[model samples]
Target: MGLDDDIAILATAPVFELFERDALRLLSFAGERRHLDEGELLFSRGEPSDGGYVVMAGTLALIPRRPGEEPVKVSRSGLIGRNALFRQVERPADARATEPSEVMRVTPSVMSRVLREFPDVAAAIHGGMAEELLDLVRGLSGVQERLTRLSPRKR
Candidate 1:
């Protein structure tokens, strides 16, 4: 795909929705494009993560560590390894290509450079993370409320 196509894909992705077109263009230019054959392993569990992958085509299977577990199939235009963008974490599951696939690899180093260069992008990312945290807290509060309701009343 061309630069415009890449930008379009990035713009539509939920993770990049807060980013401007210019930021998306910068990401497209800096990111590496990788192609995998069917049944190829994209990444394995416990591996140190450098970045995330934006699927451009085909499907990837996220396989759990436990044997006999059903793998989660992710299709086109999905983002994987999102935490890698902000932290140095290990892969939680094995990712394999279920079919011939194309992905754009976005490294944390590259993102760090971009964030340094564009303070606005960094601010936006921070805001997004804050919102996510707030949502998680709200969800937990609801769960706590449900647990309280389910518990027996004290004398």
Candidate 2:
């Protein structure tokens, strides 16, 4: 694909939407592309994550660690390892290419360069992440409340 095509796909990713054209250009120039054949193992559960992957084409299946859980499908325009884009974290599930696929890998080093150069985008992304964390906390609190009510009453 051309540079414009890469940038276009990058722009479509939720987090990348915060980046400017210049930032997108830098990402397209610096990011590495990896192609996977159908049934390829992209990453395994418990593996150390190095970066994030933006699915450029085809599909992937994020298989849960628990046997009964359904695998989540990720197709074109999907972003995997979103947290790994900023920090190193162990993979929680296995990621495999369910079909021939192409993905762009953006390392934390590249992300740091982009954020350092574009403070505004960095702030925007940070704020967005903070909100997501807060929302998670709120949801957990609600769950706790429901669990408390479900507990048997003592004398």
Candidate 3:
């Protein structure tokens, strides 16, 4: 996609709107466009991760499978890859193209550049991080509550 297309995509994404035009330009420098077929694995569990993705078209799926547990289909995205950005080390889930898809790969180097040059963009990403962390905490708390209910209680 051209710069105008990139701008349009950025305009729709909540976090991208925070980046300055100049910072967005810096992003274009290192970004790469990719296309994937239906059922293609964008990245598998435990693979070395480099960065995140922004979807230009079609759908992508997040499938998580922990050992000895059933796989879970997380959700599908039409505009961005959220899990790829905040990965701690390797991916805990698998991402795949649910249909013919087009996405832009934003490398760590470019992400670092954006954080350094555009405080607003960094702040937006941090906001996203906070929300995600909250969701994680809520999910964990629910799990703990369930476990407590299941365990034998003291008199």
Q: Which stretches of candidate 3 lie over 4 Å from their true place?
A: 66-88, 131-155
Lowest-sum lDDT 10-residue window in model 2: 1-10
Compose the digit string of candidate 1's lDDT tens values, residues 75-95: 776888888876779999999
- The CA-based lDDT of model 1 is what? 0.88
Best by lDDT: 2
TM-score for every candidate vs. truth? 0.90, 0.93, 0.68
Winner of 2 and 3 under lDDT: 2
User: lDDT tens digits, residues 34-137, model 2?
Assistant: 99999999999999998999999999999998899999999888999999999999999999999999998999999999999999999999999899999999
TM-score-based ranking: 2, 1, 3
- Point out the worst 10-residue segment of candidate 3 by lDDT: 72-81
Error of 2 at 124 (Å): 0.4
Error of 2 at 141 (Å): 1.8
Error of 2 at 131 (Å): 0.8
- Residue ranges of candidate 1 with Cα displaced over 4 Å: 66-69, 153-155
Candidate 3 on 9-93: residue-level lDDT in tens?
7656545666778777776666788899999988887777767777777777766575666544322224344554544357767
Pairs in clash, predicted candidate 3: none
Q: Tell me which residue pairs clash in candidate 2.
A: none
